[model samples]
Target chain A: MNALWKVARFTATDIFRSKWLPVYTVFFFLIAEGLFRFSGDSGQALVSLTNITILLIPAASIIYGALYFYGAREFIELLLAQPVGRKPLFTGLFSGIAGALGGGFLIGTGLPCLLHGTADDRITILAILSIGVMLTLIFVALALLVAVRSDEKVRGVGICLGLWLAFAILYDGLIWLVLALFADYPLERAAIVMTTLNPIDLGRVGIMLRLDIAALMGYTGAVFEQFFGSRVGFTLTSGAMLAWIVAPFMLALRSFSRKDF
Target chain B: MPPHDMGRHCSSLEMMSAAAGQILRLLLLFSICFACMRTSAVHAAEVRVGNGVDFAAAVAKAAAGDRIIVPNGVHTAIDVKIDKPLEITGQAGATLDGKGKSQILIISAGNVVIRGLTFIRSGMSYVSDNAAIKATGISDLKIENCSFRDNFFGIYLAKSSNCIVRNCSFKASGRLESSSGNGIHQWYCRNSVIENNTIAGHRDGIYLEFSRNAIIRGNKSLNNIRYGLHFMFSDSCAYRDNLFQENGAGVAVMYSKFITMTGNIFRQNWGPAAYGLLLKEIADSHIERNRIEGNTTGLYADGCNRNTIHFNTFHRNGWGVKIYANSSQNNFKDNNFLSNTFAVSTNSSSLQTNVFDANYWSEYTGYDLNRDGFGDAAHHPVRLFTILIERQPTSLILLRSLFIDLLDAAERALPVLTPQTLADAHPRMKPKQ
Candidate 1:
């Protein structure tokens, strides 16, 4: 455990000091500041910021995670040459990248919202930032899984970008098609279940409910409120998000452990 | 009797005269007492109801045009059915406790008046819809200066006409939506006036169903479980100067026509399915000079047609106006759309048949080169991003991002993706002050 912590801290320091992390942080800061200063209302600014966080954070995590894994291949191999086990090395690498990205997101968006946001805006901002961080973790794990499965870096990056595009954009289109085709049926419960299949939709709906704009969604929004508005629903959705983060990383670790260098 | 006979005859005559005088005096006294009783009975116009008198019995015994005055105390559960035209007045601090078993007062007769009473704890029954005061099939009934607390339905008027409910307060202790009833609920009534009422915590503060020609004004409805005021299939009604605040879904007017809604303030009705006003399948209405603020959606219209919406202020809401695709032939003019997330969002991309003209949009950036207070260039209120979000609500997370904003700007400049006919031809350069 101590060795694992040491390795993780070393990897986290490397990623934290890298130029990309600072760039990512600055991007978030500039967007948050622009929205806070330009948008006349804090609620509108919060909504805009939530949008940016959901779209950009996952893309950034995927690209950064895959690139980092490829760049640190030599270091990983050198550590594998040491007596360090595969499990700890994989765990250390995963934690380090996820922590750096999550930390960058928090400091970048969370600080500005806290400083400029009103008392009523705090809970919504917190919810948006938390979901962003969770998305970062989930996507980073998925990227690592892609990277470990392929030996070629280009193929790995392609796969990660594709996954990001699928989750962020294409998945919604498919859901729309499903809803439109089955419009005659009572599909609210089924629609809610479908939304849970995608982490992004879950996060979006979760934050939207917090922002009190789900009313515009009509019947599906009402169903979501009944499920995601309650304490048990909140726990279940949050637990599902956590599972989204854990399951992919676990699969990646198992694959990475068995693979020959 | 010889000497005693003459004395006896004089004594007997004197005794007989005395007896006759006594009988005459007694008969006169008896006639006077009978006359006084007759006059008192004839002059009994006011009935005082207290001091161990049952309220229901008093109402039953009172004749037409009689006044029943209730003293200051808590009365027992009253299921009184009024059949005669009478006035029931309660003094200060008089309360009718329904004991959570039945309705407090049920008026079945015409020309009845009820005033100055507090009703409490009417029972909850889905079958009966127990109320504090229920007026059925009556006319010229006036209820004033009453307070209702913890009742299922506050004042229910059914199949009645030409009634007035004013200066009353209704409060319900409803923990859930299904268990609660409306504050002033009217069904199948006509030509009624509901004014100067303050209502809270009911299902809907005021609900009118199949009722026509109602003049609803000067009411403050707040914090209800459902809508503040819900009108369904009620035609030719006018609502003015009413304030609806913090209700679950604000006011909903559905399947109604010829509604004149003006000068009403709708505020702080924030929720997922909430709107400042929801017009569903409504037509031929005039909505003007209303202030809508801090709601999720200021005005949501679904299948609403031929309405004239003008001079209303839509401020600080998620969506200012969300007109569905099915709605058409509506005119939106001279309205100020200020600082909402989406100014106007519609589902269809086809040319909208409705008109959006001479409106002040805070998001408009066109220069008024001619200085006519209207912009030279037309303004497109629908953004491509709004369209995307409408189709896929999950895409809402991409709101206000730079890419989406750029896409919206490009769409605005080129008019390629957005509906071509949905532009405001005479967009105001500045908001109306």
Candidate 2:
């Protein structure tokens, strides 16, 4: 635990100095502030919040998290040689990076909710922050997995970006193709299974529906409502998320534990 | 001498009676055989055409039990309406081309089965529900292994019962929000099984309104303008093994009761109103073992009550799980809240009778030093800032601000104003099965 704490402290301090983290945070804050100011109506503002959190925030987090994991591998190797167990070191690194992300998310998005938000928007604001932090952790775990598995940073980053693109763009396209070709089969069942593999999309639904935008989106919204709109599916979905957390961490630990750092 | 003569006479009389009985039996058998032959002759009117059949003429001349099997070819603009029980098999995989004008066929009768046919280019209609095949008030009807493309509605059922639609596909390219109809739509239908179907490129992938006791499983609803699946006032139904992704919204369940949604996936359904699932006024439901991921909003429950949400995953969604205003007495247990932004959120100010226990949250920081594998203290999960952010989305900028964090810490210390009943009384350090 002590070794883990030391590594966490070290990574936290190191991350604090990285220009990318602050630049993203500053950019997020500016965009968020602009959205709040420009979206004149309450309904429009809430919609903008959903877009920022789901689209902008996760997009930014994935890029940075992937960059950080590959960029700091050499430094991580140096710490690994200092007689510390790899598990604690990995945990420390994860926690430190996650903490930095959480802090950055708070600074980028949470500050606006605190200073200028109304009572009506509080739950959504908090939901956005909670979702932002969790998403950062998930991406960080994924990025670390990519980094540890591959020898070259370029390959790791390529894999990570490819994964993001497949989930963000290509998976949906494939789903459409299947639906188009096999009109006689029950493809919706397959489509649902495919979407859960992507974490970014999962986090978006988990947060926005809580704010009650289903009235606008209609039947497609109803599909999600049937799954996550209730306390029943909500708990199940949360459990799946917990699995995501432990599974990746375990994989990373296994790879790090055996690697000749 | 007299007794021997009487015995001989009795034996002769018995022989004569046996002969007479055999003759009567033969006559009766012949008459029955003649009647059976007449019945078979009267019903032998079936016409089988390999290339194609003039459906209009066939229906006029066909008997109730006769079949008009269409052979492999493209048939055009045929609106054959069934008025009696018959088998219409498309032989060697025939295609019924609508020529982009009107419906292919309409079934208004019972005990009909249409199988192994491909329908393309249905006629567009604004005032009426046009489809490649439509069944209205038809009972004991089965449509299987059929495909519908460029139709207003692929297969539409209204006021129909005891119908089974299996292995069907509905693809619509005419995706205008004003007129693009659903892929598979049913209303006021009962005991229908819509299974193993792929529905896409329309307004709704699958829609059920006021339809009850329907089994919808093994279907993929994708890239529609609207919902993957939509249910309103639809009760006593089970939707299992379905996928809802990248539609305008994922799945919407509203004003429905006694619904069991299990083993489904909801993901990548984006937009402000997008959610893995949206529940409003849904009561007494079971949502279990479903994976909800990568949507704008996951599991938004508003005013839904007496539901059990267990064993599901909420990962990488914009917002994880939310219990909105006027929702009460719901049980959320044995679920994992992994890395979601907010594990739980509520708008109730007082007791709402919601239980959030035994949930494993990745963000949980508490310890179980005794190794009992449970958290020593209750994890005060609902942050005050969460409550504030629910009401004021713009206030999120103040997160981690000294004032906001202090306020959150204060709320954790003193539990007041937030819903008192909404808590994890026995928060688990690990996920419960």
Candidate 3:
């Protein structure tokens, strides 16, 4: 436990002192602030602003987490050479990164929402932070995995970018193609499966649904409406999203533990 | 022998009489056929009538199912009343000149088919719904391959069901606000299909009120005075594969239910009050597969519930999605948020009964080292910066300021005020693969 604390302390210290992390965090904050200000009285404007902020903050958090994880790995390796076990070292590194990310999130996004928010917006504000926290943990875990897997920085960044492209662009294009080619058959079933598989979309949809702009999210939620337009279907979709959150997390954790690195 | 021969002559006489009767019948048939041919030749629906008999008079003489073939030419006329089901076929280049006085055609009968006619310069009336073609109480009415220019409502469908308007173009006259007309207006109608039409320069490209079970597909609507497609009190309608661009308020889906909008493009719709698709008092609707780009607000949804938004791309919009208060029980999933100024914003955040899950946000900065492809933790999307921006519009000038950036970083470190409820329970490490 003491060794774990040391590892966590080391990670937190490194992240806290990093020059670039703050820059990125602040950059995200500014954009989020700008969007919130410009977002108007219309439901569309408000939803759009929230969506944009959600997208950007996670991206920023993930990127920073990746870099921080790798950067902190070298220090951990040195510590390992001294006498620390792999588990303690790894746990400490993750804890430290997670803490730093959590801190960055609170400072960059949480504070502003609190200071300027209405009594009614309290839940939305909490939702925003919750998303940020989840993303911070996710990135921390992912960064650790990447750091353990490869010594080369390029590969790690490449892998992350490739994943982003697939989730953001290729997946939807594929869904569209399938839908067009199989017009005779119902694609809603297939679409729901695909959506659950895409965690990014899951997160986005989950957050937007909470914000009550799911109606405007459009096609993303159509699959649920098709089978789940009924009460039973709605409950099923809700359950499916909940499963999406849990299943992937478990899988990621298992992979992290078993990875050779 | 003489008697028998006389009997044979009588029998032959009877046969001859029978042959005479058959010949008379044949002659009658031949005369009828000849008259039909002559009638067709005289009023050849394909014959150009620019200098010929009055087109209206020719139409009056047309038979119940004959073609009023207007050949490739121009004719100036007013008010061609169609009381019967007839094919009014115009040659490839034919034009009808309305002379800017009255409606070009008024169809009040069933199964009327109007095709391949270019109507120009119809009179505009503020008091009357003067249209190039006004179809009322008509069933199976088809208006195809036609053009209406400088008219009030190009084609009006009133209490008409199963009416099809396809491959048509409308350019409504730039009249004053009260005088401006809708491109295609349908009221109290059902089972109508408006497909593959281009409409511009009017209060609304397509307006449907109290209509139901309609399909608006494959249309291009642009530069309208109010909305590209405006609907009120409509239900069970589907809009797909359409483009709404550069319009005043884009498209307003208001006071409606059970609508499905898919595979449409909403772009360049700019104005203070502009939105790509607006939802008010909408329920049990499915809005999917739309490309909402470069609009003031990609989607503005309020007073809505039990709707699903999925698989959409919101790119480079001024504001991507807005949620007003009094909206609940909706779901947003599997969407792509790319390079928008504001992705999602909402008021009445306490009513946090909505769900947003499994969407790809370009701003997501997470990793999926495990190949299972999910972020290890939750992601809080609402930031203090966004909240500040929502509260203070003028504070946007400080967007790039170092102090604001520092403050944002501080907030991220320890979330204090941002909505605790605004988060993805599971944010994907990457987008969907």
Candidate 4:
């Protein structure tokens, strides 16, 4: 555990000094402030900021994770020559990347929402921010999994971008098609399960349920409310998010341990 | 139906018994006073009922145009059938208890007046629809300044014409929809006036069925189990300056023609199938100057035609207006749509039938270079995301997301996905004050 912390601290410092996280923070700050000024309502601003988070957070995390992993190849090789175990090195790298991204997102978007939003809106904003953080971690782990499997840098980046595209855009399209095709059947439970398969959808739905916009959703929104409105549903969704985070990281760790220096 | 008729018959019998008791008491009081007042100048025609008086017997013995005065006390439910023009007035604190078995007062004669009475505990049978005050086949009747509590129906006008019900309050705690009746129920009545009444906790606050030429104004109807004010097959009616709040679903105007609804307020009617006002199968109506706020849907119209909606404000609702495919010829002009999730949503892509012009939409962003108080470009109220979510409601999880916004913006720039003709040609530059 001590060695893991040491390696994590070292990698976090290296990533922090590169100044890429500042760029991410500034990007979010400008978007949030601009939305706040234009929309003229705190709730509307939160809604727009939530949209930005859902789209850009996953893409940014995946691309940044793959690039940072490839850029730190020499450092990783040097660490492999040390007395450090492979497991700790992989854990340190994953935590360092996820922490930096999550921290940047919080400071950038979350702070503005808290400052501008009313007291009643605090819980909803915090819930949305936490979902953003979870998406960051899940996508970073998936990116690492793609990085460890592929040998060439071009192949790794392609796979990372493809994964992001598939999860963020294509998955919803496929769900729409399936729902339309088999609309005769009772596919509510199946639809919910499909959403959990995509971490982005899970995060989106998790925050929407909190926003109380389910009344506009018609029937399916009612179904989701009945499922996710309860404590059991909340626990199940949170567990699914945790599984999404851990499963990819474990797979990436196994492959990294087996790879040749 | 036979069972319902039987229940009505039984309730009438109970009312007769109560009237008989009041009459017996009145006779005893008259006998005691007969010995003291032997002046022969006493007007024996005028029947006065004080404490422990037989009110039913007095009504039976009186002729037309006689006045019956009831002093302050508790009286039995008097179910006297009036065949003459009479006035029944109660003093302060006069109460009539129905004992939860029969109708409190039933008037079948014309030119009757009943005022200043508290009626309570009418029978609760769904078959009978027992009411505190039931007027049938009576013309030119006046019922005012009455309070009703825990009755199956508060004031019922059946097959009556030219009646006035004003300045009354009704309250009923109904646990189920099927078992409860409306506060002021009018069936087959014509030219009646219902105004300045407050009603709560009934199936419907004020219900009109097959009634025509009725005027409903300045009433507060709130927290009812169903609609605040519901109209069905009621034509040529006008309701103005009424307040409907927190009902199951706000006022529903259906199957009506030539109706005028103006200056009403609808608020806080939030539910899955709830709306501020529902206009179904209505035609040639005018809905103007209404305020609808904090509802699931501000106005939901289906199968409506040729209605004019003007100067209404829809604020902070889930959807400002959801018009189904069958509706047409509805003109929405000079209205304000503010802070709703979707300004207008329709099932079909055709916008040729309805007109949306000169309306102020908060989401409109076109320039007004001509300075005529109208935008230079047309404003499209329907979004592609709205159409998608209408098809698949679960897509609402992507509400306000960037991808949806991008798609909306792209669709706005190029009229490819959304309905091309569903644009307001004369969108107002500023909201109507």
Candidate 5:
């Protein structure tokens, strides 16, 4: 535990010294504050903030995770040469990245909402904050997994970009195509299960349900309420979200522990 | 009509000799007229009752046209019946508690007046509609300035005409739909005026079934379990300047004619089956100058015809207005549909019979090059996405997605799925209001 904290503390401070963390934090703060100031209603501002954060957090976290891991190849090799166990080193490094990104997100968006939001806006704000941090953790873990599996730098970046595009855009397009083709079938619960397969879609569904705008979806909204708004549905969604964070990080940890570097 | 008339109504006179009964009936009519004349000649008697006496005892002892004054205390009464024409007034802080077991007051005569009473806990039962006050088969009944708490029904009027229920507040906290009742429930009533009542947390705020010519004005119905106001099988009703907010299904008007709903505000009634106004099988109505905002669907028209919807503002609703194919010959003129998700969607309509002219849609992107108020290009309110969702309920998962917007744009350019003739011909460049 002591060695793990030492490695984690060292990695966090090293990243903190860079200017990109401050830039990302300031960007999030400015957007949240601007939305709060301009949107006449705070509830509306919270909704817009959730929409933007879900989109940006995954993309930014993926790119940053890939670039930082590839850029520190020599440092990782030097640390591995020391008297450190591979499991602690990998866990420590993963925690550092997850902690830095998630902490930055919560502080950036949470502070502004807590200051300007109304009493009823607290639960929604907290949910939005957690979703943002979860996306950051999930994407960073996926990027690290890609980085650990591949050796070529350019190919790793390409794979990360493709993963981001697939999850962020093409997945929804495929779902739409499936819906259009089978426009007559009863695929209600099937579509929701597909939504849980992708982390970005999970975040979008969570925020949309909170906004109470799912009713605008007509029949789909009712089905969503039935499946995702029940206690069992709530538990399943939270379990799926936790699985998204755990599965990718564990794979990346195992691969890093056994890698020849 | 007094104690004598009461005795006559309660008596079984079928065994009386025919000749003798004829002469007695003539004498009884003459005596009633003489008694009315004498009561008019003298001042109406006033009785101070119900401080320590029983409330039913007070009603039984009072004569017709007498004024009974109830003092400031709790009157625990069970099934008190008012059978004579009497004016009953309660002092400030006077209460009628039903003890969670029985109905409170039942008015059975004409020319009855009730005011300034607080009714509490008339109980809940499945067998009957337990109410704080119930008026049946009476003419010219008035209930004013009363407050009701936790009663199954606040004020129930059945087969009564020329009644006025004004300035009363009703509050019930029953959560389930079957467990609660309406605040003001009227059936088979005519020429009734219900004004300035505030109601909350009931099954429905006001329900008028088989009632006609009811003028409901300046009432606020908020946060009820079902509709704010629901009326069916009634005709010639006017609702003016009322505010309904956050009810389960907003308001429903079904199987009615000549409904003049004007200057009402409906906001934020959002649920799966909720709408700002649900109009079914209604015809020849004038709905004007209303503001509907933030509902799931602003107005839903099914089998509605010959209605004029003019000068209303529907702002930021799920669908501004949804019309079934059976709804025809309705005129939508000079209304502002602003920022709704789907402006107007139809099941499968050519819209050949209905008219959509001079309406401003916030999503309309056409320009007025001629400097006229109308746009040169026609604006079709039915988007292709609505049709897709209608075809497959699962496609609703793609709502608010970027690809759906692309699909809508592509379909707009080609005009494939959406009906071409369902459009606003003279789309206004700006809102009228």
Candidate 6:
């Protein structure tokens, strides 16, 4: 436990001093503040910020995680030679990156919403931040998973980008095609299940379940409305998001422990 | 179809009383009271009847143009059929209890006036539209300052003309749409004025079928199971300064032509298939200066044509305007679209001429370099993401995702996917006031 904490502290300080994390924090601050100013309404600003958060957080976390893990390959190997266990080292690294990104997200988005948002907007901002943190964890885990599985730097980065592309873009497009093709049939449940398969989409849903509930209630199917209306659906959707955060990290943790350094 | 704007329409209606035309209402009230006093003083004999006296017998003895005044009490007035022209006025706190039976009062005579009465519990019937007051084949009927509670239908007017319903309120208790009736149910009626009425918890607040040249003004219709103000096959009618809020299916203006709707508010009518205002097979209509807010879909046009939707404000709705491919030649101008989930989404993949021009959209991020009060960039109201959501309803879960934003940005940059005809060519830099 002490070694894990020491490693986490070390990696955290190193990433924090590198100037990228602070820039990331500032980047979100500017966005949230700018949206609030430009729209002149906290509700609408939160909506716009939600869009930016759901879209940018996953990409930034994934890319940053992949690049960081690949760049710190020699450092990781040197640490393996130390007295620390492999599990502690991997867990520590994961916790360090996740905490920094999550902290960056919560503070970056939360402060602005605190400054400009209404009481309701503050609630939505909390939901958004929670989704943002979970999204950061999931994407970072996926990135680390890929980085650990593959030895070549280019191959690992390429696979990470492809995974991002698939999760972010192609999955939605496929769902669109299927829905268009089978427009007659009831695809509400099928579509929801498909969305749950992608972590980014999952995170997006988690946020929208809070934000776009009014609009979602407008959907003709009872399934969509029930999803928004019922407590059971909310719990399940949140459970799925938690599973998303856990599943990838577990897989990455196993691979990190097994890798013969 | 539940209404889209059901979120805050009731609040908007409540807000409307304080927001607009308070002074006008006061002046109008004074003039109206003065006119009523003058008209009543010159009329014929007055017969006082209430509290266990046979109301129908009193009506039978009263001569034409006589004023049968019902005194303040809970009078058992059930199935009173009046074939003679008389003025039946209720004194303060006059109540008519129907005993949960058939129609309370049936007026088949012309030139009749029913005023200032409280009506309750006209029985439910499957085959008939049972009402508190059922008037048939009459002309010059005036109903004013009456309130109906727990009735199937408040005032049922059939084959009537030159009628006026003013300052009345209708409240129903039925929860199911199948069993409920309307507030002011008009059928085959012409040249009628329905003004300053409030209706709630009915199937429809104000329902007009085949009723022509009617004016519905300053009515507050809310929480109906079906619609607030439903105009079916009603032509040459105008409804102004009305508020519709939180209705079940929302307000529908269907199979109507040559209608004018202005200064009205359609708010909070939210449901799965809800809309603030729905135009189905409607043509040659003018909807202007109205507020449509917080609905599922603000104004849905299906098979509507040649309509002028101008100077309206659509705010915080699911979709500001949803047009079907079949709708044509409708013009939307000088409107403000603010904070809607989607400004305009259409199933019209290929463009038909439904002009969206000079509207202010909050989603538009274009510069106005020319400074003509219009953005330099042509604002396409329909986004690629909207198209996806339209085609694939389940894809709504992906709202506000990074990929959806990219697709929208790409569509704006390239103009490839979104329909070409839905663009606001002269998009306003500021909201049209």
Estimated TM-score for each candidate: 0.73, 0.58, 0.57, 0.81, 0.78, 0.86
lDDT of 5 by residue, A1-261 (tens): 877898788777777888777778888899999988865456557756876787789988888888888987988898899988888887787778778877888888988998898886777887799889989999999999999999888999999999988888788899987776876687887799888898888887777666656244355677787787789988998899999989999999889988997
User: Where does the lowest 10-residue lDDT sum fall in candidate 1 chain B?
Assistant: B35-44
CA RMSD, predictions in order: 11.7, 18.8, 20.0, 11.2, 9.7, 11.6
Query: What lDDT does candidate 1 reach at residue B328?
Result: 95
State how far residue A191 of model 6 sits from its true place (Å).
Answer: 1.2
TM-score of candidate 1 relative to the true fold = 0.73
- Once fitted onto the true fold, the runs of candidate 3 whose alpha carbons sit more than 4 angstroms away are A1-261, B1-51, B173-176, B410-417
DockQ: which candidate is best?
6
Error of 1 at B289 (Å): 4.7
**lDDT for each residue of candidate 2 in B207-235, tens digit (9 for 90 to 100):** 89999999999999988888899989999
Error of 1 at B69 (Å): 4.6
- What does candidate 2's lDDT look like per residue over A41-64, in tens digits? 333455456656655555555566
- Candidate 3 residue B213 Cα shift, in angstroms, is 1.1
lDDT of each: 0.85, 0.73, 0.70, 0.84, 0.85, 0.85
DockQ of 3: 0.02
Model 4 interface Cα RMSD in Å: 2.8
True contacts kept of each: 0.09, 0.01, 0.00, 0.20, 0.29, 0.49
DockQ list for all candidates: 0.09, 0.03, 0.02, 0.20, 0.19, 0.46
User: Per-residue lDDT for B271-298 in model 5, tens only?
Assistant: 7788899999999999999999888889
- Candidate 6: stretches off by over 4 Å: A1-10, A40-44, A70-89, A118-123, A150-154, A180-185, A218-221, B1-46, B50-52, B61-72, B84-93, B110-112, B347-351, B384-418
Residue-pair clashes per prediction, in order, are: 4, 117, 130, 4, 0, 22
TM-score of chain B taken alone, candidate 3: 0.85
TM-score of 2: 0.58
